[model samples]
Structure formats: structure tokens, C-alpha cells
Target: MTESLNISIQFGGGAELLFDKIKKREVDLPALKKYLPDCQREKWTIRELLLWIKENLLREREELFLQGDSVRPGILVLINDADWELCGELDYELQNRDTIMFISTLHGG
Candidate 1:
């Protein structure tokens, strides 16, 4: 009885290199209802979405994209054009039509 979450994912500052060189994508994450009752929520949090991104969208070199269950250092995450840090970082709950962007600051190091 849950609806799909339509969101936009964008990679910039060379972060797209890790995503098959694609800079933007419109993705649909299934409703949290599909998860275990204990983990299910009214909406998907960034923490949960990160795992889903790693499993579904990441093409390779997970280590380069993630660190200890979160995005690696030197990478910037933005949610709906606002800094994720200001939006509670990983704890930010995502909503329909949300735009999540990842921009890597580390490149050619």
C-alpha cells in the first residue's frame, strides 16, 4: 500500500566518473514498507538510501564511493540543493521528488 519515491540523483565534481560517467539519473526507491517492520519508516532516511545506492546504483569501486557505511571523506552531499550537513546529514529523511547530489572534492590525487 506504499507509493514509490521518485528522486533525482546527480554526481558532479568528477563523482560521475564512478557512476559510469552518468551525471544525472531519476530513480525510484521502493517504499519503506518493503523493509522489515523494525526498520520500516514513514519515509526513507539518507542512511537507508545510502545502502540502497551502494547496492543498486554503484557500478564498482565501492571503497571509492563509501567509507564505513557513509560517503567517503572529501565528497560533498547535498539534498534538494541544501548542504546535507545542514539537513542532519545521514539522518535526513528523504521525500518524493527530492534531489540528492554527490560532488567529489577529491580527484586525481
Candidate 2:
């Protein structure tokens, strides 16, 4: 049987504008092995989550949300209400029911 991860995603600090003005969503992510055939890891990480968001959720201005493979400089990432940096950044493994939030610190002039 294939396993799936159910998690919460939130966008704030105007970041929701990039995601069709939606502030929160519940998502079901397929197993890494099934989602990415080349993936050797058994679990999903923040790195893969970013790619998933870009492909499935992000509406436009991808440059404002992603920088290379990670979030842009002005965006803050939180996993389960804690800073992503404290959770190993891109290497952080995702857990079922985890809450991931993206907040844009950049403001328009």
C-alpha cells in the first residue's frame, strides 16, 4: 500500500497573494518514491515540498517565492510553528499533520 502525508500549508505577510490569496490549505502529498521515481529517500523533505508547492500551489511570481531551490531571502519558513532553520532547513523531513508556513517579509513601497 502507498503511504501519503497529510499536512497544513499557510501563507501570510502578503505571501498569500502569490498563492491565489489563499492563506491556508490542507494537502495530501504522495510518498517520495511514488512522487519522484528518481528519489532515493523514503521520506519527504522540505526540499521536495518546495518543488511540490511551486508546481501545485504557487500561482505566479515564482521568483518572489523561490530562490534557486529554496525560498527567497525575504520569506520566512516555519514548520510546526518553529523556524525552519531550527528544523534543518531544506533537509527537514516532513511529518504527517505538520504545519508549514511561508511568510513574506518583503513589503511594497
Candidate 3:
């Protein structure tokens, strides 16, 4: 059997399933898992994670992360060994057996 989405998280290289659940899951579960190791380790479903963050984390559009402030928190970001913005934006479509990477960066002296 083969999965429609096959992505890799460089540091440890974890396996994940990618699917956008508009209504079912309130949060971006797959994204949280892929990018945030802590979220994945907790084994949180997209629905759970999203609701949690919606109720816990996430701020206003003052600081947009993905896409042109339209996607809000667009999943399927591609960034390997680098930060989020550096990688391609949400425009990245679904690539068969695609290996997506999630990287968060911080800049300072």
C-alpha cells in the first residue's frame, strides 16, 4: 500500500499523513505535527490540535505566517533545514509521495 502524502522532518524523520479536513478537525493537525515535534509526540489528531490552539495559541492577523494572509495558517509548507518563510509558500500543491519539510527560524545577533 502507498500513502498519498509521504513527508519527512529532517531532524528525526517522522512519518505523517497529510489531508486537509475543513470541518472535521478545527485545527491544522497535520501541520502542527509536522512542524512541532512536541505536538506530534503527543499524538494529537488534527481536530484536537486545532481546537486546542484556537482556544489556546494563535493570535490575530497582525502577524500572518502562511500565504497572503488569506490561508491564515496554511498547511503543506515546504522548508527543509530552514525557517518557515524561507521555504515555498502555501502555493505548493500536493505532490505524489511528496516529502515536505517544516522549519522554524529565529534571527538575532
User: For each candidate, what TM-score against the reference?
Assistant: 0.91, 0.97, 0.26
- The lDDT for every candidate, in the order shown, is 0.88, 0.95, 0.33
Which candidate achieves the best TM-score against the true structure? 2
Write one digit per residue (lDDT tens) for candidate 2, span 1-109: 2699999999999999999999999999997888898987889999999999999999999999999999999999999999999999999999999999999999989
Which residue runs does candidate 3 get wrong by more than 4 Å? 1-3, 9-88, 107-109
- Over 9-88, each residue of candidate 3 has an lDDT whose tens digit, in order, gives 22111111122212112222244345454543333332332343334443443233233332234243344434345534
Residue 104 lDDT, candidate 2, scale 0-100: 94
Q: Candidate 1, residues 1-109: lDDT per residue as tens digits?
A: 3888899999999888888999999998887778535674677888888888887888988888899979999889999999999999988989889999999999674
lDDT at 4, model 1: 81
Candidate order by decreasing lDDT: 2, 1, 3
Which model is ahead, 1 or 3, in terms of TM-score?
1
- Span of ten consecutive residues with least summed lDDT in model 1: 33-42
Ranking by TM-score: 2, 1, 3
